[model samples]
Target: MKRKVLSIILAAALTGTMLAGCGSSAKQETPAVASDTGAPVSEQPAESSATQTGTSGKQTDGKNVPELTSEPLTITLWDISTEDPGKTTMEEAVQRFMADYPNITINQVHQQNDNYKQQLVVAMSSKQAPDMYIHWGGGPMAEYYKSGFVNDMTEMFNTYDHPDFIDAAVAQSTYDGKVLAIPFGGLSGCDIFYNKTIFAEVGVEVPETIDDLEAVCDKLIEAGYVPFALANGSKWTGSMYYMYLVARHSGNEEFDAAYTQEGSFTSDAFIWAGNKIQDWVKKGYFPDGVNSLSTDDGQDKALLYDNTCAMMLHGSWQVSGIRADNQEWYDENIGVFRFPEDSEAAAKGVPQDVEIGTAIGNGFSFNCWNADGSVDQTKLDACYVLATQYFNDDAYNQRRLDNGTIPSIKGFENTIDDANMKVVADIFFNASNVQLWYDQYLPASVTEVHKNCMTELFGLQKTPEEIGQEQDAAMKASLAE
Candidate 1:
């Protein structure tokens, strides 16, 4: 409830629009930003940047920060960034951090996003946990904190100068009244990225409602173009469609109730979303064998790039990813619009503006534990400096911006030169509520069941009723445990 209220307030405060709207061209993509070096490099007097300054969040890091020494320290850092933009940006941050501290070695490892959670679990079980790792904060984060894998960085934050982040970002990274992770990227909002050239050729306007969307899809199919590019080989890709459909069909009320086990997963809204997706599938709207095509291998983008598909419902990060591969093509072709609303649901008084996305993208959480189960002070201090200072600096922010990513840290308003990114920013900041992805928001066990249900749901291997019952059963058992 508090999170919702705070989101509403933040939404109200950010009602203003960006300089360029969605229709603008990408002639001017990169903007120069003046970086504020809040945390200093080793070349500077480190004492000057360690003073406490900003304060507008919860959690207190009361743990001790060990004094820095020139001793050699090798810390492993794990993340899911095997693809463009993310892959290069994270790697550069590591290089800069190492240069700043010549003695500290960061063994950076990139893992595929689809299998990251399972790999992390296996590593921890095998007693090979990375010193610092990336995660989407929610149930899994809380579970990790409870199991003593999280290191509270509130004390480090209190003692060091850090960039000002949105309250929502801080809220998610915090667990058990402690700051467990550091925000690494901008808010990730989900929207429909359509091919502008294809739309013009098909002679259809941008959709305003689900009815309009369906009409557009029919026309696109008649013109021999796939309506959507979806690679459900990664189940979360299909889950995005299910999420938005459910949100539009009944608003956040049903999902909120369903998630808490207070309402049935077989409710009218879930069934409606399921039925709608299957109906589209029968119409040959998505790529053939979407469940077999992998987004990790760039198969989804392949459809759009070749003009075989007219649109893709995906995260705002798709902007950066697309641009990284071909800026000229992206500039000439890509345009963004919010997911079409459900007019019937809105007329029935279900809130239609509750968006779905993450307030913080991927956050880096520290696990500074020794073999003896005690905090490793030296490691904690090094990671603290690496995350809060090196990773959040202006140079790093510029590189992210160059890749079309807006940092979660504040004060980049004048620097977002890309029109699509500007449009996404406006949509993201003004939403009444942004729901986190269910897979990331649910517990690990429930998440597995949910993803499996998505695969089966899209494969037409199970009835909507069957998956709903399975989900309801999973939810209830998870709650009971």
Candidate 2:
């Protein structure tokens, strides 16, 4: 029998207005809250003998009773999918969940992607925090977890059957051996996506090493095509280049040491990365005014689609947008590749196959604790039901794949039919190591330094050593706090 997968309309009506303003500005001071109580205010589930099987074929043996109170309840969810098809997919899931549990009301709030992180932090520190919110799980999440702004879902995650959850997704959401959030949506990482037509025009092929990549760039430039499409106005887009270069040069151990403050950010690896990016800029490898182009405006994408640029380095999340905008062109001409190995790094004994990015995914974190250090059991339970329905349910997972997201649920690979999605999954699954994005991997203060310095490096305003020193200073200041 053919299964009925949830059809994503891609026009899901968002239910709530923006609770916070949009901007890159963030509050520097942490919110004043009472000290941690060492335990959640809500009652922990006791041991149980009864086990229940969910439709996904996973059995739950936990003591969490699935009963809901007869009284009406409402919970809020802040998410970064203000536009289709993400908004539509989430809306449908919410509708289905509400139908199943008529007593609970979910106020789905949508936020623009550009200002989500900043606004979320502001909301969390204020009285307007939602019962749950979606976020990229990494350093920002780590800060939230440390400050007790979010709840520990370690117990809840274990109680549920998660046979389909991907290991990388789970690891990304876990911190200090505790599951802090529910794995949601697709697993993403940065990769090189190029126009095969342009490569053919320049008589070049996908490069396997740093030298080969530079050679390809030269040929493309000689043919009057931009070697890489870049937009640094938002900063993070350009940071991808620097991040990959650092990964190739230093590998994960050194980067981790530097991020955790056991070592200095002003390392030889980091300086080399900055130098390489500035060298590429000097070589006219990027599009004009790369520093001023905004990625949100599709300027970088326009270069690739029109064949004005030969390549782009971005996360796999761009796959859906490309296919949606031009399916036929994408199917026939687009090709994906892992970032090439740095020849110098290889010569210095760095592994040739080490990937420069991470398999980071977005997920929902429970606002389990309130400003007064109390947990509303009903709200927490209701939030869990909604989160699991959206992320863990078979139909919802199918919807994610159908919408071009590389779902974090195990066994989703078999259901995925898109050629481009398969290629991305293959790259993600085969990667030897995946480091989280530097901006997300480091504290906010240090991330700002990294992004600013990356822009300055590309603009010829700062030397590699200067960029490193600035980042190291920021890291020390953040660590000191």
lDDT scores in order: 0.75, 0.69
Q: How far off is residue 9 in model 1, in Å?
A: 40
Model 2, span 124-145: residue lDDT tens: 5554667888877667776666
- How far residue 295's Cα lies from its native spot in candidate 1, in Å, is 2.0
The digit string of per-residue lDDT tens for model 1 on 1-481 reads 0011112122111111101112211111122234353221222122433332122231112212234547899999998888656788788888877775668899999998776776776665555678899988876676556556678677666555456666667777776567778887768889999999999999999999999999999999999999999999889989999899999988888887887778878999999999888889889989889899999788999999999999999988788789878999999999999999999999999888878788778788988877677788789888876776657666677777776667776556446778988988888777777778988877666777889999988988887788888888877666655
Per-model clash counts, in order, read 2, 3
State the local distance difference test value for candidate 1.
Answer: 0.75
The alpha-carbon root-mean-square deviation between model 2 and the true structure, to one decimal in Å, is 12.1
TM-score of 1: 0.83
Task: Please list the residue runs of candidate 2 whose C-alpha ends up more than 4 Å from where it truly belongs after superposition.
Answer: 1-48, 51-65, 356-360, 370-374
**Estimated TM-score per prediction?**
0.83, 0.84
lDDT of 2: 0.69
